[model samples]
Target: MLDVEKSVLYVAFGSLAEITIDQFRELAMGLENSGVHFLWVMRIPFEDEFLNEFEERVKGRGVLVKNQWVDQVEILRHGSVSGLMSHCGWNSVLESICESVPLLGFPITADQYWNARMVEDYYGVGVKVLTDTGSVRGFFSSECIANKVKELMNVECVKGKEIRENVKKLKGRGAAARSAMEEGGSSWDALDMFIDQLIFGKKKK
Candidate 1:
């Protein structure tokens, strides 16, 4: 992990989304094939023999955290973390943007699809991992996962660089948002006004 700068990829699908053991196998194989250092935080508890073997094979380069709660923000903030392979839930998208870490979106269900599009198409801070059938949401192959991981981690490439730059810009905007909530900022002023109204009742007019 220390061999490279901004070389690690962090992967997590939200707890709400359920994935089968087969999908997990593909993700493991793909991350290994990508040859990128990765930390995958999984909510599912897979007590499978194959997972044990897979972990040993990718021992030094990849880490699998199963059925555990990790401090996701802390992981994203690490200097070695370059990208997040995520389900593109709204909170995950915002966290990636705030940390300036580029995203490799793998939206599964519900509003995740919309959020993934916003990350990829609208904000341009991420790239979507498409299925074998070229659909945005569905079962995806290990090859597809490998290709997308490589694409996101390839900083020398045009697309990867563009996404990195975009995420940086988005992170700046997030900073500005924080400032807006500080004292004397617009959000502060609005909240002050609201509190005054609640305490005094409509300003007597």
Candidate 2:
């Protein structure tokens, strides 16, 4: 379904997000309104019937994967996936960073809010959706979702450019950290120290 190269927005709400039906509809509408190509991973209990009309409306531009387990890392690494709309789970955030893709954070609960803040505030790699007034987990309007998606994907926008640059730099740092675990590197030295401590304890026994 993701045929285009670097042209699709990839969306998933992790494994535990409890989205109300209304909120789901709003997200569907927002994706439609965004006018960008997308690949949405829908969890079970949400039937294709719920989005039949939406699918029909966005036939050529959108692809929906329903009630199926997918290799998220593979899809994120694909050239067709340009951005991620995620629940800001740490694993998802790191995956996006490693792949050098920007984010559209829709955090639900737990540490997700903090992750979202880090993405937008600390890391400068994403934007968060606004919650409804007077409600902690209330629905955000489709318009807000559409606008944020557009802003994040707009290459000419300052924020978009910053996010791209930030993720690129972060990816480089991650690569260096991984390389540090090789022979004669700092991480290798730390591992050797840990092993020596274990051996010393055994000898004392």
Candidate 3:
């Protein structure tokens, strides 16, 4: 699933609809440089014939590139995982919050920018990676990837602790929000009143 063993890094790229090779490489290099064990699921860049290039690289590093769908929940909660390289999609974001897992935001899609903004700006939960080229597709250096990954991991050490605390503070607000929409909550009451006014006014007219 998440491969939570200490120093083990599990990366999910295809989990979300979109991701950048540029971002992925940066993280891979980061983890490798920091002496962390890595599991990266990269989309085979070319056809079956070209896949050999990726295989050779994986072989060289003593790493495995798997495409098997992983149970992210089990892995994130497992305690061996130090951080996630995610696109900050809503589902992924919620899981990280629930599991108290750390994140490195490599977001690159619609609404993902807003999700990343919410995390880094208000939640204090993750770090956003900035690309030098800014192109959706570009040649990226693995060295840069490694450095950013190292930074995200180091920063996550403290921010993760803070996020857990924030969870406790926000859970109450979440419950209140739910309550406001239930059978007898604020939203329910408002809907009831509007229906009554509309029916009575129609009869009067």
Please write out the lDDT profile of model 1 over residues 3-113, one tens digit for every residue: 346999999997788877888788888898899999888876478788889889989888878888888888888898999999998778777787889999988888988
What lDDT does the true structure give each of the candidates? Answer: 0.85, 0.83, 0.59
TM-score of each prediction: 0.83, 0.81, 0.60
**Root-mean-square deviation per candidate:** 5.0, 5.4, 7.7
What does candidate 2's lDDT look like per residue over 1-205, in tens digits? 5698877899998878888788898899999999999999987546657688888998899988887888988898898888999999877887788778899999888988888878888889888887656222557899888988888887788988888888888888766654565687677777787787797853211
Clashing pairs in 2: 6-80
**Which stretch of 10 consecutive residues in model 2 shows the poorest summed lDDT?**
130-139
How far in Å is the alpha carbon of 148 misplaced in model 2? Answer: 0.7
Looking at candidate 3, the ten consecutive residues that score lowest on lDDT are: 44-53
Kindly list the per-residue Cα lDDT of model 3 for residues 69-110, writing each as its tens digit.
Answer: 677777676766666667777767766666666666666677
TM-score of 1: 0.83
Candidate 3 CA-lDDT value: 0.59
Worst 10 residues of 1 by lDDT: 172-181
Alpha-carbon deviation at 58 in model 3, angstroms: 6.8
